[model samples]
Target: MDAVQGLETGDTFILHATFKPVPLFAVMKAKGFTYESEQLDKKHWKVTFVKRGLGQ
Candidate 1:
């Protein structure tokens, strides 16, 4: 799973630590977000899921 972007523990993120809600980082990985695993650390990931629609 991916990590949260601009993660500041608070203020910048919603900080969802609940079983009902999946971790933001996990959500990112599930969305197919990738990175240079060879160079990147396990703590640096911020994948987001944008809903696709006909129009904004």
Candidate 2:
């Protein structure tokens, strides 16, 4: 979660993982980030998150 800690307003992060990161998604969503996710293959997923304004 280092990415989350370093995020600033209007920053975006993209991550690729071997499995769907449901727990990570939950934490980021709860922290007021907006995101989209897509499955790229049987064993890969991509998730993008944007950090908006504070308390968003």
Candidate 3:
């Protein structure tokens, strides 16, 4: 929730995690954010979350 709280409309953030945060992606999508995830190596994931024009 901190990530979401830190962002405003049209803001973007890159989350780098040790594993793919599939659940987080789903939750964010449900909240009307857009995202793309890329797996780097076996233990790294880069997820870009964007707060688009959503009422939140």
| Candidate 2: tens digits of C-alpha lDDT, residues 1-56 | 77688888889999999999988877888877888999999999999999879666
- Which is superior by lDDT, 2 or 3? 2
Enumerate residue pairs that collide in model 3. none
Models sorted by lDDT, best on top: 2, 3, 1
Give the TM-score comparing model 2 with the true structure, all chains together.
0.80
Over the stretch 1-56, how does candidate 1's per-residue lDDT look in tens digits? 22444333221222222232334445544544322212133444332333322332
Using TM-score as the yardstick, the better of models 1 and 3 is 3
What's the CA error at residue 10 for candidate 3, in Å?
1.4
- Score each candidate by Cα lDDT: 0.33, 0.88, 0.86
Q: Which candidate number has the best lDDT?
A: 2
The TM-score measured for candidate 3 stands at 0.80
Provide the lowest-lDDT 10-residue window in model 2. 1-10
Error of 3 at 1 (Å): 1.1
TM-score of 1: 0.22
